[model samples]
Target: MHTTPLTADLVRGALDLERTEHGLLPHRLPARARAQCADPQLHLAESQPSGVRLVFRTRAGTVELDTLPTKRVYVGAPPRPDGVYDLLVDGRPAGSASVTGGNTLTIDMAAGTAEQRPGPVGTVRFTGLPATVKDVEIWLPHNETTELVALRTDAPVEPVPDRGRRVWLHHGSSISHGSDAASPTTTWPALAASLGGVELINLGLGGSALLDPFTARTLRDTPADLISVKLGINLVNTDLMRLRAFGPAVHGFLDTVREGRPDTPLLVVSPILCPIHEDTPGPCAPDFGALSSGRLRFRATGDPAERAHGKLTLGVIRDELARIARQRAAEDPHLYYLDGRDLYGEADSAELPLPDDLHPDAATHRRIGERFAALAFAPGGPFADRAV
Candidate 1:
């Protein structure tokens, strides 16, 4: 090995290296923040770009490679409401813990199980790291749809790098999250990240992307380089709001994201195809006959006549997003919009039926992720004008 003199200038330059303190970095942080690699906050939007890096490192062997630390939390009830969180060491099922208000949950690999006791949400410390362990991979048990309150860990914090790559913060319903998709890595956003080659901060909050102001504020307060908002489906499915509230809520949602990401690229996307609402507005109900026949179908809940004007369905949402985009374009030329049909419209669904009426399976998720990356990250794409 060639040996060069250890010079004072080399040390000076190395010490001078600095990254802006932001995003996910490794270091001694608040116990809650350190427990997870990235800040445990969700910023909802429509779509995400790719090609950004968020790196976290731990002392080699200092973190146990086979034991996972508790870093996930689920609020409210999910499809599987058995446990609030689970710990997986090295991607294998290790154990689980339950959350009761103000209760302390512990996972001690040394003890070979998890235990819950009365206490408050706080830092979680894991002993017996291999001392040669270089990193820890975290698997979030909850779907992307859920919100996060805190994270606690035992690593020193590092600064999040700008990396000169565009950051896409997206908000959408379950489809955006890993919903019916096979695994977390297969989620549309994750696939999009791999394809688009940009940094991502996903806020695909499963069923709650109803243009809630709190969700919007979450976006508003967070930082991003690019942003998008995917709307429709959820509101129609849940029958959450009427036309009056939907339109204004969308506008409000966009406005809120702008508060923090001023001058950032923003796109508004409508919902993809759903046959029942292709033309009619709706609180679309499951078709009993179709259910019995094992075909996915939906019907208007209210009067057939009223269905035409009552709520915003997939089609209606597309139209409204176009209108909204056009209306806002003069004021903000950087803002762009994409029709949901541009994604998986009726034809695509016909060929690839979603196993569930509400969520797309892994295949569809991959398809959508690829399509999104091609459009948003391709040369001269809608996001092309922005610095990416």
Candidate 2:
């Protein structure tokens, strides 16, 4: 077997890599941005490596990766499924597996506390590959924090060459962070990037897309041919800011991105249809009854009447985002606005209701990916060939 040290050049989509006692841990946010805030939620989300993966070319019939996965458990809630690692051979789904051992993070949602327990490292192996040398991509679990301990293959491997594809940098909320998606490759962003033939650098921080200046600056500095920002859901659910602060925040965020990429095709996407937060203002709360009944669900606790006092709702946010897009597009021809509903809306809700009243299910994730690829990557789409 050929053993290779996990190096930075072999990993794609992560903004930073940290050498840990176990192995190389990929980070979606750089040190500066991560240092800007000590929010635990942000810390964990950025470390999950949603679109990160190892890319190499090899003919190894058998390949194995040693990893330490951090699995999260909500005390008293149902046990979550183990995170999935997807193996793609020559751009096609070849196989998938999950690690057996790693670390466990037991979270108490109601009490807002968490405990971490260390565990043994586990190995995932894939056998029976084609004999010819082919490109292989091992997509890390989108929802779990994993440490890359080592790589072993029956044949030697080298970094995959760049394919000259446009790099799409995307930022959004938990929905974008693959909340309920089946695996890393199937996440809406990953699927969309595949269908659109672009490289993906996903910054979909679950519950952490609060339009922080540091986050905006992170987007500003990342090198990307195309950029998209999916906002509103995190803003609404967290009830982070009211209307008075939203517009300016959006502008500031866009301004920062423009500072580094003035002519880059920038797409602003509103939140998809989340019935609970559509008409009702948010500051969403988990439905304790559902939790007690062994189901997980959320509800918007804010009153619709609060709209008069500037509380934000999904509906309100869409209008504001549209207005801002139009107001900005007048000056920036490359700026684009996409109604999130065009990807998933009320009609979609009727057919594919969000299982938890928030995040889309796996099927919905596929639906959104297909729709987004069609709308945003088509010939007339804003992200159409840069040559166009």
Candidate 3:
């Protein structure tokens, strides 16, 4: 069958796009911002296109997407599975697919080095669709860096018109990036976006939410009616800063965002419950025993006594965030705080244990999404549409 090509202009939900030699690369961070940071983890996470998708109206019986996906593998660890591409017809999941044979990124945590091995591109095809015209969305891989080479459809495709939903801009670490979620749409942020009836621009870069200045600037420049930043976990896991540095960093991050959105409803959320890092400080390390058995889990390796010397634990971060929010709120009423525990606390953890001792599982994502919707997006909530 003859195919019509669709371009990046037909895509939505991505914060930025770059035209690469292969095709269009969707990025959570724009080129200007990305150029300022040389962090490999940030580079990898932003390019994965967590909330990005191609949305168009079509009646095509078959659709094809050609992509070059870069998959990651840790040395001596269990092989990772191929990232999933989720298809939605008129807003409901219709099918799923995965591409094979792309680039491979090999990481040696002990050596602190990574290398990329190039490979051929792969295609994902979805056939047997109905003839009736419908809105179709192809959600890109939430965990793999995908270079969208081509989008082909049996029928001509056009961009889905804006539905006048409020734009929600959110930034955080892996949990917000859909870590361990079963599918792209089922990610907690995605679920919350759906429930809040908003258009989401997710900047949830795994292992890279270090309160970077460029990230704050990106948020400042972006147009968003509602904004949130989930902070702390990444800092603890990386042991990036002491308590004194964290307070200023959080303030600075919020300051930059307020530059662009002076009155926007900006929310500051602390880290969710991660038992390992609650009282113990980090540099969290993977549990080798778990990994050897083909399971992945993290254990805090920093000394608890180091908390006296200004090291940060999840508990420390939460208290600091609350203090920062309260002090700032006196001057900036629009700024707000939601204890991350409210979304996923000790009680919730008891019911839905985090399988990796870090990231929440698929079921917990739903629970957090639902609770977030009620607390932040419901009537009288911080993000509620006042016009309604």
Model 3: residue 334 alpha-carbon error in angstroms: 1.8
Please report, in order, the local distance difference test score of every candidate based on alpha carbons.
0.54, 0.95, 0.91
Candidate 3: give the clashing pairs: none
| Model 3 alpha-carbon drift over 4 Å, by segment | none
* Residue-wise C-alpha lDDT for candidate 1, range 81-154, written one tens digit per residue: 22223332333333443333333334332233445554333222244544433433333333321112333334
TM-scores of the models, in the order given: 0.62, 0.99, 0.96
Whole-model lDDT, model 1: 0.54
Worst lDDT 10-window in candidate 1: 9-18
lDDT of 1 at 4: 23
Residue pairs with colliding backbones in model 2 are none
User: For model 2, how does the per-residue alpha-carbon lDDT over 1-388 read when each residue is reduced to its tens digit?
Assistant: 9999999989999999999999999999999998999999999999998999999999899999999999999876788999999999999999999998899999988888999999999999999999899999999999999999999999999998889999999999998999999999999999999999999999999999899999899999999999999999988899999999999999999999999999999999999999999989889888888989888899999999999999999999999999999999999999999999999987889999999999999999999999999999999999888575
Q: Which structure is stronger by TM-score: 1 or 3? A: 3
For each of the candidates, the C-alpha root-mean-square deviation to the true structure, in angstroms, is 11.5, 0.8, 1.4
